[model samples]
Target: MTRISTSIIYLILFFINVRFVKNQQTTNFSCEPRPTQADTTDKLQRLRAHLVNNNLFAYVIFSEDEHGSEYVQLYDERRAWISGFLGSAGT
Candidate 1:
């Protein structure tokens, strides 16, 4: 498929996943022991240093993989790893 078509497909899937998650009932299952403010600050500092060393301006962390699937592998949880938000709806 063309790149544009592939992108459209992914976009559609992402919206569907979002809608599904939003419609779900809430539970008391929280992502416990959320990262502290200091932890986030430290993570950002380290990430900034890495970006500078690599000559990069910024980094984009997403909650989904290439296929826009909400159910991702552990390796694909960059958003949750960095932000400590494990929700299925938003990152």
Candidate 2:
């Protein structure tokens, strides 16, 4: 009856809202502030030095919590110190 019709309308609205939210989250990420030649060279040299100092044959990976529970700012230093990715989920 009227109650069932209202329930169907509510369900449709709920699904539409969910789809809109999901679409909003879809994004394409690109590196910002593209590094200058000198900056790139410096980063390369720093990476080399890190590898040499650590005697590492393979790149090291690191990660931080993505739950947004901890202070993500605190991990900025570690990200700067590392060569590879530093993310909440995957490194």
Candidate 3:
């Protein structure tokens, strides 16, 4: 009975430690400003031309949201346009 109780205590401590470590992890991510539409357009146009020359299809998507207000979406088109990565929370 004593050994069983000790095992349970160890299991509880292990779970608590796991939870604490998980909670301490940082959730922040940031990126540099995106490029202008003209820049993106120029790059996309070049990419499209290359694709057409190679007989390939090119697809692209850009998105942005307003900054400062969490209520608004930031303008992140340049980030996505150049990096091809999207922030789920618009950070």
Best by TM-score: 1
lDDT of 2 at 71: 61
Residue 28: error of model 2 in Å? 26
Worst 10 residues of 3 by lDDT: 57-66
lDDT of 1 by residue, 31-76 (tens): 4554553235457567757866796554656567878784799888
TM-score of 1: 0.43
- lDDT for predicted candidate 1 compared with the true structure: 0.62
Give per-residue CA lDDT, model 2, range 1-91, as digits (tens): 5845755665666556655543453334474544531224356466656755796433433344455345656555354444433344433
| Predicted structure with the largest lDDT when compared to the true one | 1
Give per-candidate clash totals: 0, 0, 7
Better of 1 and 3 by TM-score: 1
Pairwise lDDT winner, candidates 1 and 2: 1
C-alpha displacement of 87 in model 3, angstroms?
Answer: 5.3
User: Sorted on TM-score, highest at the top, how do the candidates line up?
Assistant: 1, 2, 3
1-91: candidate 3 lDDT, tens digit per residue: 5845755665666556655534443433364445732234456456656755786443323233444343334344555565455565322
